[model samples]
Target: MTLDVDEIERLYAYPATERPWVRTNFVSTLDGAATGTDGRSGTLGGDTDTRVFALLRSLSDVIVVGAGTARDEAYADYEVDTDLRGRLGLSPIPAMALISRRLDIPQHLLVADNLVVTTADADPARLATLRESVEVIAVGDGEIDWPDVLTIFADRGWTRVLCEGGPSLHGELVAHDLVDELCLTIAPILAAGGAPRISHGAHTVDQQMRLAHAIEADGGLLTRWVRDRDR
Candidate 1:
């Protein structure tokens, strides 16, 4: 059954919390492949997933992504939907934050008004060029200290953080215990080709998650998992 706008909003809505909520949204195939032959998650999602993706973006205050995903996905500057912003009482279009130590971001993305959350040892020359268009924040020496990144986001009042992953970033978030919820869409497609799973990294931590809800549409399954804080 196709979900209406109101129903979709109700399904993905977050409750009033004392602190910022961090959520990660991803799409995968039935075979546990996070990508397809094209090496992008976009190929795995269906029409229903698209609606959910847009809704997640509209509801978020900031969109956090790994630099690799940002480059591979060819991210564009987020456009402000004034009508939705007014209705939601949001300040502006959600800001995009790219995390990278290389500072090797898409050229057009750098020109757009965004934030580069990088480390201190990032290439100075590349950062100099990016600085012309984007704001740069140095949080670590080589690897990004996830905790510091969360603190920075919270300090800026960007509490509703939405992470669109390339896996490694999601792994880091999971390892640091920064992920509060996960919205995963299981595409109906059965991908036999080799691909990474939703979360990939050397740093692994066993954390239990509770299924908050699950919905079916267009033969695909959209599921939300909230961290079992008691675990």
Candidate 2:
């Protein structure tokens, strides 16, 4: 079924209150992908998928992205809809959270309520510099601890999080059993050589997910899955 704006909005809106977290992970084909491999995801999906993506971002309290994705996509803070915020019982804008092992971030890219999650052993100077621009959070015991990171977000009242990933980070989350839901958009075109596949994580068939739903968007397939409870 082709997704429409009302359906997209309703899907996101319903999940915001029922689910604690929702992660949207996607990858594009070769031959200059995701908006022509020049590196933009704007053209990757159709109008419906685009609206769905925007709604997903809008309903999230925090948009969690890997540092690599942030750099490659030239990420920026999304303007929040006050009406949506009131409906979801959220503040004006959602926080933009970046997960980076190093402190190598550009000062100009810092958003007003941006956050950097790094290891406790990260360079002091880098931490200080980031503090000058946005919130700097140190989690784990000198490593990027996933458990600690979740606890940190939980402590900060971020129950609903949207992780827009770039493979490696998604693999890490999958490996750690941290992902509760997966929303994948599969384009009709294939990139047999250029970009990597949707997931590179190591998992047995027992780790397979159960399909919750699927929709046709922009001639491609958008599938949602939930981890098998029996697994």
Per-model C-alpha lDDT, please?
A: 0.83, 0.70
Off by over 4 Å in 2: 13-22, 27-36, 201-206, 228-231
Model 1: CA > 4 A from native:
79-81
**lDDT value for model 2:** 0.70
TM-score each candidate.
0.93, 0.85
Clashes of 2: 2
- lDDT against true structure, model 1: 0.83
Model 2: worst 10 consecutive residues (lDDT sum)? 27-36
What residue pairs clash in candidate 1, if any at all? none
Give the distance in Å from residue 207's predicted Cα in candidate 1 to where it truly belongs. 0.9
Report the lDDT tens digits of candidate 2 across residue range 1-231.
Answer: 766656766655534333345465563543324433454565576676666677777777788888887887777646656787787688777787788888776666575678888888888888887887788788776568877777777777787788888666777787777777787766676544455454555663235777877777677777777765422
